[model samples]
Target: MVEPSVPRLWRAVLPICLICFLYLCSFLLFFCATNSLIYSTVCLLRANESYCAEIDQNKSLIILEESIQKESSQWALYGTLSFAIIACFISPIYGSLSDTKNRKFPIILTICNAILTGLIITIASIYQGTQLCLILYIVANIVNGFGGGTLILISSCFGYATDSCTHKEQHVQMIAIIEASLNIGVIIGYALCTFVFELHTRIWHILLVHVLLLVLALVISLVFLKNRSLSQPSTNNLSQKIIQPIYDIHDLFVGLKQNHLLISFLILLFSLFFYDLFRMGSGSIVYLYLHYMSFDDAHYAAYFSFEQLATCLALILLVLLRRRWKVNDLYLAIMGLCLSLAAPILFAFAQRNKAMIFGAIPSSMFSIYFAVCLRAIIARLVPEKDKGKAFSFVALIQNLDVVMGTIACVEIYQASIDFFPGLVFIFAATTRIIALIFILIQGLCVSRTPELLSIMPTDEIEEPILENQSDDDNNNDDELIHA
Candidate 1:
């Protein structure tokens, strides 16, 4: 059979690619504004006795660090959790909109939200000492939420790309590039913060600049992007076309209510939920922990950056493996189990000596490896039409990484300092074990359901020709972007 040509990343979407690059630059510059300027303020407050007299929590560094440790740091945990609610609303809805309308509205919404987010933060900084940081934080979180909540935007596009592909292996490669872009964004953001913004040194100004970068990115993206119609509208009735996405979201709950496949993925969800919570919440501790034990903060962040870089590099290895292994549900479950093990095991050993623990502990870099794998697995499980809803369901909880990490990881650190040091590992480990057990059980049950058995590949199952469309395609959405 003649094969359909799948567009390569660098070649297919030059305009969108430029938008992504400018967006990355803007995101990293904002990081420079917010974090890099403030590193020493952190080091000083934490290591007060080393230089100045007893440091005050209200001092520049102390307050910033505490802000991160607390649930209410404005952008860290509490506020993010609240704004994430807004994201939960926007992600899937925008995704459906993109599929129906070719992603223009949501992409436009993103540009507007990003601009508003910056303007709001800049305003808040003007009133920092007054009774206004709280309000600004909330608005900023919501704005950023709206701006960053476009994961489903890309997911929908990739789903379209996947649907267009003839070879299954091509789909996996495309998804890897998307996932890799996220890691690259993180690295650039941190590097910009460390070298440029100096956020740790200056409290308010840099943060405002970070806000401006969001606006800047929006402007850049708007200038560069060119939209293509994704899906054709159905003639049955405009009403059904308009409401198809809403029905898609409803089908998700219904799917969970009716099917066991969603439940199997949920087993993996718990691990993602808790692991993110602990890791993000306790991120600052890596430097602090190392410094307290007489290590260098610059070197520490560098080490972390390197670890993440390594993980990104690891994606290349998966490209080779994906083609060999069938990208199926059972394998996804197996990979999930493997990732769940990394965290608790790392946390369990983080209590050991500094050098050894740093080598073994499950840092953000290590977690990204798991994230990319899980994402690919999830993509393979569902059909293209439902991919937006399915991925949004994952995004609902996935983006809460910082909040959950703050709660599970940070709160644990604060309480455990003198009381129960190993509790972090215990909590992390136990959570994974429970999730793993659920997955094993779910996996066995999935073996029996003929609906699932027929859809997914099994030891005894034979590979079937790729269906023209999954059930969602039968819905034949008119208003979608094109997933």
Candidate 2:
């Protein structure tokens, strides 16, 4: 059979566009679920008696800060801590399965799980008892984290991107584009939350909207997203196929042990994990912390949207800077680290809303750059076949960081909430300094091995075949199918 040739760029364009749209929907689902869960949790904790007054006769009356009090920080801490605990283990498995099977299904599964989680939180928000709501909150976290939450969902999306792109330079650009999509989604979600909170006053309604968006995202995935067959389809029974990903954990260790570049990449990921740990830990509590600063939901949502916009702008700036300067990823990373290092310090000592808002600006602007560079680097470091495992390990690190940082920050905050509400920020800032040092070392390694930057194989082009040559055309068609 004679095969018609298609343009290389055209082959990638459709999948890339679909992935970007999926990212938008998935992140919208993410931000909405997170904002609703945290805001409702905190508000409920602060105003528990209002909902449970008939049942709780022993509870004392307290309405400081208009039902947004210091004690409400505990809900933020517990919810985040519980989420990280389950997600840390699940993310690696999800990543491995993406490698062993396909990326699209795992991503679909995550969105479905997120929808369920949003519904549970909504039910919890409308319930009457504090203990019952907390139990439901814990249940919601378990479901959300069971499929690995946002990190695994994003890693699968990224793994799908790597499957489509073959060149190193293109990988970097695509990763940056994905990071930008995440920022854009955050901004949109935050704005929507702001609008809903201002207009409606009922937090459960916001969560219902979140559930609807997840359904939309799932539909989009089912209709538009294409799954590439990277690995051979398994011949095992359905039960074994389902259980096999858990055992695929060995692949991560094998990839790291067998490949030197993968080891170096893992070291770099360690640095990012520290940064993410502090960043996620502090982020979980920042809204409640802001409440103490006299900021309302509208103010917090608006400022947060502004910060996400700043992150998107920073990526744009980085692209421009790359065009003009002889800068490396590590160099750009250092610049971002310096900005991130300053943010938590400013937050820690900020006595006024202006300082807290200003503190968010620096970290928000450059943090995405660090992530972009890290993902780009890892995408280059691992072989094409192991990209899913590599990204999964990275996701695992993110989950562990979230768990560790949450535990540490929650403990520190609980102990110091009376005397020092800002102590957790100081600890978070210290972790950033540690991450900076690791980045410096990674920068030195990349400088020493410049070849690491261009590690991805370029896409191969097929030579033209005359119509008389049927055998050559069939071989080329088979190669194209495999590619």
Candidate 3:
């Protein structure tokens, strides 16, 4: 078969890129709106207008500002927990569906859910300072969570890219490009929030824009993207269809348990878990951290956008290194983990706005390396049929991070806000250290057992045909051949 041209391949993945870009823009806009509204509500409930106005203007009411921060953080934690708890359970189901069904439906469902969330948030912001507003916020998160939220969209996009590619090299490049698109979306989203807020626009206005963009994304997914799946047809029984993905997850666990490369899989999973725990924990509270450092919305957005740009550049560099230099994924992951470990420490010690902003540079350089590389590595480890379930499992771990990381970092930040607001970053740094240890151990294991590299069939190897063999025998032979 002739290989497709580069431009043709890019065209195929453009829809995935656009969808990711739009979803992230909506996600960040929702985040900024939520935080701003939470702060406004806390001030309204806790203090008089004159005092709140003074706090907003003066920026030196240390005690009162800390109080408001703690209160707002508590509310933010609740909102995050509500969404993450639901998404944690729903992610696997959607991931399984993408594997067993098609990728487009999940992508479209997520965008529709985002649009609904934007509308709910807009209404909530209008009713700010009321209990109903708080209730609506929680309800909106629950609704978004039920649709699988950002994690599901990301998982499905990765699964879609994986399905579209025929070779491991192409797979890695596609994953890198998708990861870059995610960062680009984040950068533009934050920048847009800053720009609109600088114009003194209301939170609802920004949310309206978010909803419109999501509607566009929904249209793209529905009309432009093709339904793609590698799994066989599902059973006609409704009950079986409902439970099959869950069963697939269980079977994946069983398969992992019995695999000869179980140690490598566990190490990679743990590394991903700890790294995400650090990332999510730090990210959930980083905005608040910047707030404490006297940074405004524009400042925070610029800082975050710069960091994301650096991350995007790093991903591009990774793709080049893999394609041109033929760098091993494990080595690149180790390098990224090593370089990223210092960022949280720098953030912990940062006292000035510049210090806090620049502290992320070390991390921005290589922090995304492990995440992108590990997913590609894990993809290479499993069979094609298990890719969806495997990525779903990854998404489950990330959602778990959303719950655990938010709780841990928010609690830490709340406790230390008065004395040392940087404590949360220190905790994040510790998690990265743990991730590094896991990756190092995996590298050692791989080096000691070279045959572990051959666990999966590469694209260069054509599937063998079994002459006059039973179906059962052929299936067994296929597994053995791949193994």
Candidate 4:
């Protein structure tokens, strides 16, 4: 293969591809930054009154004690968990709708919701009273959660990528790229957040920036995104709309059963649940732990940015390794889990801020490993038409983990704050170990039967549709394009 001819059409599409790629990267970067920094910012602000009061008990200031700070953090986290609970019911519906309708509509709507969230949250941060801020926070969460928030937005994007890809390898590549873009975005967002906070102590200025970014993302989505006409038309009446997601769940179950990969997928789902549990649970409280260790806002932002940088590097390294070695995804996932397992241990035992920072190195790799491998595996296991539903289900599992894990970790942290604030990290470490076990089981199952490793091989995946697909399925597919 000295040279391969390029298609003229590909050249024509190249500019469009670049724009889409840029849009994805920008959207993910902003989203990741927000995710990395938002909870910590809220917790820190809420704790500030306590922190200041503790420092100067008689300064005529409004400050609670360390216990109050911890309590405030817990309640803010609870607000987040509540939003996640609400989002759980919406994710599947939006997912199915994305599969049935133009993904752009949901994508745009989600970005708009994010914009609103950023604006409201900025205003909330400005409020001196915690009660008012909390109320605003709840309102923001309600708006954003009802719009399906980040989970549905990401799933829809993935579903779009799934529809566009022609082969298993391409799907894997797309997922990796998406994950890498997100990691890079995390790095950008983390640093930008820190810079903004440092430059403007008020903090709401950073929120304004986030709002601007969300608006840009929304505009890009509206202007450049195109809907795919891959699915068949559906003939279900308006009455069926309410139960569509439930039926989609059934279809997903049926799809899993037909593939004989139900056990494997379930294992993946459980692993994801625990992995997210560890990730999100630790994420919610670690800032408070760092605060307890005397780290300031800059230090906190730097720590998160470092981890994201590590994740970005890990993804880049994986891409390079794939070219030079026959690296297995299972081994990569294990490596990630091992890092995840160790980071939490280090964090839990850390006595100083520097020690806690060291843990970010491993935790960074942990961030990139599980999602990339899991999504790649899922992309291969489900039918093209059901990709939206399958990913939606994954999102649901993740949201459940986020809500439950956050609640559990916050409670643990609050209960043990006086005696052992690090207990939450220990709990996180335990969950990672459990997640690793589940992943190992999945790896072992695939290793024993490599032929069953991928549902369709790179060469044999054919086109988007299969010959055995039903007429109803075909109609559903077509209708989604028009819906």
Who wins the lDDT comparison? 3
Pairwise TM-score winner, candidates 1 and 3: 3
Model 2, position 213: C-alpha lDDT score: 69
lDDT of 4 by residue, 264-351 (tens): 8898899889888856555647766776666665677778778877777787776654434535666777787786666776777776
1-483 in candidate 2: lDDT tens per residue?
A: 333422343344445445444445445544444544555555555556355322122224323432443444566667777788888777766876787778787888887888788888779767623567767887888788887887887788888865655344455556776777767777777887778768845667666776776777778777767786678987888788666656665665566566556556667888988888777776656765665555666777888888888888898787665544535666777788887776777777775556666667967588777888778777777777777877888888888887777778767876765567788888887887888889888767665765654542233321221113346557767999999
Top-down TM-score ranking: 3, 4, 2, 1
The local distance difference test score of model 4 is: 0.66
Model 3 poorest ten-residue lDDT run: 460-469
Model 2, CA-based lDDT: 0.68
List the candidate 2 regions with Cα displacement exceeding 4 Å: 1-71, 128-130, 237-249, 323-326, 448-483
lDDT of 3 by residue, 222-250 (tens): 88888777767676588777677789988
Best of the two (1, 3) by lDDT: 3
Q: Each prediction's TM-score against the native?
A: 0.70, 0.82, 0.90, 0.83
Between candidates 1 and 4, which one is better according to lDDT?
4
Which portions of model 3 show Cα errors greater than 4 Å? Answer: 1-8, 48-50, 53-60, 236-238, 257-259, 455-483
Clashing pairs in 3: none
Better of 3 and 4 by TM-score: 3
Find the 10 residues in a row with the least total lDDT in model 4.
Answer: 1-10
For model 1, residues 1-483, the per-residue Cα lDDT tens digits are 323232333334443433444455445444333332233333333355344222222344444444333322223444556556567666666666655555445656765665576566556555543335555656677767765444544554455445444434355556656556655655655565455323344435545555555565566546654453456754547677556767877876576557556665665566456545454445444434443333343445554455556667756555545445555544554564555465455545555355555565343233444555555556655655566666666666656655555556556655664444556666666655664565566567667766556444434322122322333333445436566
